[model samples]
Target: MTADDRRVARYAAAAIALSVAEAALPSPLPGIKPGLANIIVLVVLARHGWRDAAWVSLLRVLAGSLAIGQFLAPGFFLALAGAVCSLAVLALAQALPVRWFGPVTASVLAAFAHIGGQILLARAWLVPHDGVFYLLPLFATAALVFGTINGLIAARLLALPQGKATS
Candidate 1:
């Protein structure tokens, strides 16, 4: 494999591991998660670029779903949807000035988009009921909390000397 391929794989592996670990945690709410793996994506975005970060995020969703035995399940669809939304937002956010926008801002925007996509998908495919919208407040709140935390962590990690290591 090429060097870039190896690098992407390593990042994907790390993200998948974090995803699995997050899966094991007991969440107070069904759809709420800390999304710790996203920190890797944000870091990759800042250090490398958006394309590399997209690879990492997409691979994480695929490999993580397979590892967690959630492949082709509703959970997998939700995850895929969220990743798609997050990546899209990140891509758009990339156009902003780097000095004014950073990992924390990107993370927050992506997190909200991720949750919004999941809710929309769930309402259309999984629940098919309007009542699912009622859960928006809870999910939105969780997204804000976790997104900010993950963003801050990414920002802090980006500040560290070792954090800049690509390998």
Candidate 2:
């Protein structure tokens, strides 16, 4: 495989591993995940680019879902939607000046977009009620807190010695 392909594969594997680990963690709410996998995506966006980040994110959702036996299920669709929305937002966020739009900002944007996407999908497929909106406050708070924490971790990893590969 090509170098970029290899990088994408490695990052995708790491992200999938994180997804599996987070899946094992207990959550008060069904959909509330720490999104540890996103840290790798953010780092890839920095070191690689949007395209590479997109590949890694998509692969993680697909492969991670299969690994967790969520493939082709509602949960898998939710994850796919979230990843697509997050990647779209991150692409736009990247247009902003890098001086201000770094890991944390990108991550926050991505997180909100991810949650928004999930809400939309859940409303359409799973819940089919306006009442689903009621959970936004709690989910958004989780998004903000977890997004910031993951962003901080990504920033630290990016700051490490170049010889040490986050991949």
Candidate 3:
């Protein structure tokens, strides 16, 4: 593969791996996930640019749901919407002169947007009982914790030389 294609493939693999890992992780709150795949998304965005990262995120979510047997579930649609919204946030962040915010800020914004979309989708489709509202705080908490960790990891990875050997 060409260099860019190889890079994208690598990102996609990472995202898919993380997505499956995240899905396999036990969650106290149903439909809530740590968004571990986002670490790869942030890394791709920082290194390859937003377009490539967005594609990775999209593919990851789609393939992830299929793997987890939730391909056509409301949760899958929520995830897809969340991924799209998160990418939009990332793209907008890239345009701003907010270098000081760094990947951490972008991650937080993207994470929040991702959860927000899921919340809206859940409220619209399955949780007509308004119980979905109760999960917002949990989602927010998970997003902040996971987003910060993912952001820091991405930041550190970006600092290393390209294709550096990892233990």
TM-score of each: 0.96, 0.96, 0.90
Off by over 4 Å in 1: 162-167
lDDT of all predictions, in order shown?
0.93, 0.93, 0.83
Model 1: colliding residue pairs = none
Candidate 3 Cα errors over 4 Å, as ranges:
1-3, 164-167
Q: State the lDDT of candidate 1 residue by residue for 1-167, as single tens digits.
A: 88888888888999999999999999888889999999999988988899999999999999999999999999999999999999999999999998998788999999999999999999999999999999999999998999999999999988988633474
Cα RMSD for candidates in order: 1.3, 1.3, 2.5
Q: Which candidate number maximizes TM-score?
A: 2
Report residue 128 deviation for candidate 3 (angstroms).
2.3
What is the per-residue lDDT of model 3 for residues 1-167, given as tens digits with 9 covering 90 to 100?
Answer: 76676767777878988888788788888766778889889888887788889878998988888888889887789899899989998998997675577888888889999998888887887677788788789889988987888888888877878774221
Cα displacement (angstroms), candidate 3, residue 120, comes to 0.3
**TM-score-superior candidate, 1 or 3:** 1
> Model 3, residue 12: what's the lDDT?
83
Model 2, position 15: C-alpha lDDT score? 97
Which runs in model 2 stand beyond 4 Å of their true positions? 164-167
